[model samples]
Target chain A: MSMLKITDLNVYYGSIHAVKGVSFEVEEGEIVTLIGANGAGKSTTLNTVAGLLRPRSGSIEFEGKSLVGVPAHKMVSRGIALCPEGRRIFQDMTVRENLEMGAFTRTEEESLEMRKRVYESFPRLKERRTQAGGTLSGGEQQMLAMGRALMSKPKLMMLDEPSMGLAPILVQEIFDIIKELNAQGTTILLVEQNASMALSIANRAYVLETGRVSMSGDANELLHDERVRKAYLGG
Target chain B: MGFLTNLINGVSLGSVYAIIALGYTMVYGIAKMLNFAHGDVIMVGGYICFVCMNNLGLPVAVAILLSIVGCTCLGMVVERAAYKPLREAPSLAVLITAIGVSYFLQNSALLIWGADPKVFKSVVDLPSLKFFEGQLVVGPINIVTALTCVLIMVSLTLFTSRTKMGKAMRACSEDKGAAQLMGINVNTTISMVFAIGSGLAAIAGVLLCSTYPTLMPTTGSLPGIKAFTAAVIGGIGSIPGAALGGVLLGIIEIFAKAYIGTQLADAIVFGVLIVMLLIRPAGLLGKEIHEKV
Candidate 1:
């Protein structure tokens, strides 16, 4: 069964249609990525799924339950978490506090267990646990953002542009962590502009252009596609 | 002796300002709007306590609790009815709405309680404490006020830094969208902020009236403005900043009134604000926010 299925979704920002009739599904334990350039509505689709953006017309379902009008804050309890674009970590809070906030909807015991797992996954977070989030380096912030999202222990984790700004090595490290998280039983929905790295790690890929999906295929096939190479892979 | 007395008076008054300033800072931090109705809520709290004590003949403890609860509900109602709808509205628009709410509260109080100042019976009837061989005089009300303010500030600090709900409040203040994504009910957190802030204002109101022994429709106005100034002086979004700013402003105002001209006290307070802004725009204990591109 599909973990998340967004069908015929249309989202707008003040009458400017941002995501038009976009539809996709993420099966259980799969890493599905949506890759596109800026203005391609990749973030919009993820945000809509996370209940942050209202879709003008369409349906979002998680585990076959309609998520059309469910509020954003309630999405986590339903087992879906979105690590938003720009790595919007709470700048004033300490790193540990940010992690704690990720488990905002969980019981004390569950949250504590999740915190330990997150610390084990990202040991650097434990080292700088008391440091303010704003003080962290870009790579550290990205790690914290992912770690924070993981604190919720969601069955489906949606990350938006986790590698938007980072060194090449850091980007590789982040992708590696993403792969590891996926291997540990959390299905992933990734939105990224880094088509090369995203396509490499994703099980399936969708190419969005101008608010619509232009292509969908197995990630390996799209990685070698001629048109994809010309537009996104620097052929 | 005069200096010592003035210092005590400053601390007492500053403590009151600190309590009210906490309301301003917390609401502003979480909601990003200056809740101008905050002062009127204080007035309402004062009136609630007055009615409970004088009209209904309740004990002081119950009266205080009822007033706090009343103000908490008022804050939540104001947020739900007025500010929540305007959450996405322009800051200026929300600000204007707050001003409108403030007027609504004041006018309603005026209509109900009359324009005449009502004498507030002394809630704290403890005897005065003498210091410096009885040269300096201090009332028990002053001591209680200072102690209460300190206790509240410390507890609030712990609350925001330690509790789960408090952590969510900080997150919401930082980035509302991100906080919501974390499955935090942003609306509930904001309402909690209003509840806590208004509850503090209620206590401040009771202490304020007890100190001055007068309750009027506009009783909360001057102190409210002063507390706002204190919030700005300490850094509007920083909790510790509010407390420090309140105490400093109180001391400065008191000293100015003692040595400087009485009319110049307000000017002095504002002048200090200007100086603080010019020297350190972030205020004491306030973090400098650099907008991310």
Candidate 2:
């Protein structure tokens, strides 16, 4: 049932070992969240799986196929998409153009269809379809990023810090959207610093600390765990 | 020649500059590197066209097509060999390599074609136009160059703004990582840009030599610099900007020569550029980098 799997992922930036022996899995139709503090390997692990970062030593498998050494651009065509840490939308490009770019590997007809579907899910993006990406508000930018990722029609979508800078209201809106997406049969791998919100929506959770998996369990069970409550949920 | 005649000549010259500037602007916008060697590609194109038409006895249209194809390949090879390995290296390194490539192209031409100048045959086989008791004249090359520039500009704008590949190119220019996330191959897009730019260089070369009627190892250097200046004037990364800059620069150079001392014309042209930049640092159509805080 595992749609995505990673084992012993080790990533380094020059001499700094960022992600060391970080392993995890995302089963089909499940919301798997990785929760951790600053400098934790959460983003690093997500990027490694997304094929953006070269692992020092590890293996990444998607639907039973090896994903290691695959370039980031090739990952989307393989049914894996990463909505990166920042809402790194092409600022000068129109919303429609940004979405079109998301489906780069798809045929013209398929991309147009995907664009219509994305617009339906994010009506606000459709409203500003011709507007430049940089002009959108933070919440709208987040929606555009998520919608842009969906344009690829990936089997598993990985999000890194999607709620990082959003207001509480916008954070709630984004989480709702994520849940809505998962409910529609899309598998989600979410890496978040906001432990409580991520745990609430996630089916399962993994806790990373200083480049390793410190703890992990059923999302609800970890939510009640005393140590997790003390460290992440603010006691 | 009347004022109308002078204006047409300026516009014709500017058309060639605009075409060359498009190559500079497109590559700079997407790859974020000033392809200094882009100008030398023009010289290479000119030589290729000359060989095909003169030695092989090919027709004008076929010679130009062959030249474009050859330049496109050269651009890709240059990018792969010189620029690709240094993609992650500093911009300065890439720029130095481009200068090296420029010199290499120049020397290669000198060695192959010899340093002796070749009298370039005008590609414009059409008739020239005359008006107002034959006081004002428009050379066939002028009409051809202007139309070609306009056509190229319109198509390039449409291609970038409307097509999927064009959108991918814009995305890569903005953010390579995000573009990659969207399944766009950044390397391939960069290669495509070089291809387009160099192909344009070929057309510009033929048009340039046709108007000037002289071909040498350094035929493309002055015009290349002027086109680069044109690209800067219109805003380095903007497509329309390059066209505007090229035409404006061409007019200024022509007017300066006619009205001012012929010796001071180049100075006046450069002086206008200085004054223009001081007035609008981002160039005529360039967006100021002042991000909204």
Candidate 3:
């Protein structure tokens, strides 16, 4: 069974339908990527899955349990976490505080234990744990956001545009961490505009256009597809 | 000698303002609402403590505690009934609703307690402190108010920094949506802030009444406005700023009353606010986040 599944998801932002009948799945221990253009509902879909936005009609199943109406705060305990777009780290809070808030659903001991693991995964955050999150550089802030999500020890981690405002080297480093975390058993659902880099690391890929899935296949197959190359691969 | 006396009185009055200002600043910080009814909540707290002591004949400590709990519940209810539903509404709408709630509390108090003013008995029983051969005098209530205000400030600082719930409050203040995604019940955190802010209002009410020895439905309005001015002077959402603004306003008010004409004291106090705003619109300690964003 898939670790996460959504069937016929229809989400609306007022009169605008953001995600129309979008169905997708992320199996355990696999890296799945959703590549799309601007305003194609990639972020909206990820947000709906993370429970930030309620779908007007659809079913969201996580580990075979329905997540249709679960409030966003309760999603952490259900073994899912979203590293939101734009790295929404608390500016006034210290890095450690940011991570503590991420692990808020867990016990103090578990939070502390997970802190150690997150530090192991992203050592940069540990160095600046005492500093406020806003003081960090762009790359460091992204790392902090990702590290914070990992503090929950989520079974499935969804990242939304993690590489949007980072340097090429930083983007490569972040993708490496994503691949490494997947190797360590956390399923990954990634959304990115950098289709080439995303597809290179993803086990499978889905192309979304105007709120609907345009194509889905093994990442490498789509990477070499003639139509995929012309449209998204900058032909 | 006269200056010294006024300074002591100023500090005492300032301390009460500090307590109320703290509450104002905190609710503004976490919930981002002006909570105009906060002063009315103070009026309610004063009435509760008065009833508990005068009618029920409860001890002063228990009376104060009951007042705190009552105000806390009232604060939460006010949030749920008036503020929560309008969470997505424009802030102006919320502001209007707050003003309506304020009037509601005031009228309710008037109906329940009547228009007659009650003489409040001082809760503090300690002897007055004397210095300079009794030429300099400080009431026990003065000392107690200052001490209690200090204690509350220290505890509040520690609570927000050290405890998990406190951290949650800080997180909610920063970004509610992000905080929720971190597994925090945003509504619960906001409600807790209201509870705390209202609890502080009880203490402020008691302190104000203890010092003045009068109880009326409209008693909290003047001091409430003054404390809000103090909060603004210090920087509305900044904690220590509230204390500073409260003490400054208190000192200024006392000096104006003692030296200048008594009727002009309030005018002078408000004049200072206008001047402060003209010079530093962000208040003394408020960050420039409001700068033309």
Best candidate, lDDT-wise? 3
- Candidate 3, which segments miss by more than 4 Å at Cα? B290-293
lDDT of 1 by residue, B217-238 (tens): 9999889988999999989988
- TM-score, cand. 2 vs. native: 0.98
Report lDDT per candidate.
0.93, 0.92, 0.93
Q: State what share of the real interface contacts each candidate retains.
A: 0.94, 0.94, 0.86
Q: Estimate how well candidate 2 is docked, as a DockQ score.
A: 0.90
Tens-place lDDT digits, model 2, residues A42-147: 8888888888889999888899999999999999999998999988999999888888888888998998999998888899999999999999999999999999
Candidate 1 CAPRI assessment class = high
Pairs that clash in candidate 2 = none
Candidate 3 achieves a global lDDT of 0.93
Candidate 2 CAPRI level: high
DockQ of each candidate relative to the true complex: 0.92, 0.90, 0.89
Better of 1 and 2 by DockQ: 1
In model 3 chain A, the worst 10-residue window by lDDT is: A18-27
Ranking by DockQ: 1, 2, 3
Could you tell me how far off, in angstroms, the CA of residue B106 lies in candidate 1 after the best superposition? 0.8
Off by over 4 Å in 2: B291-293
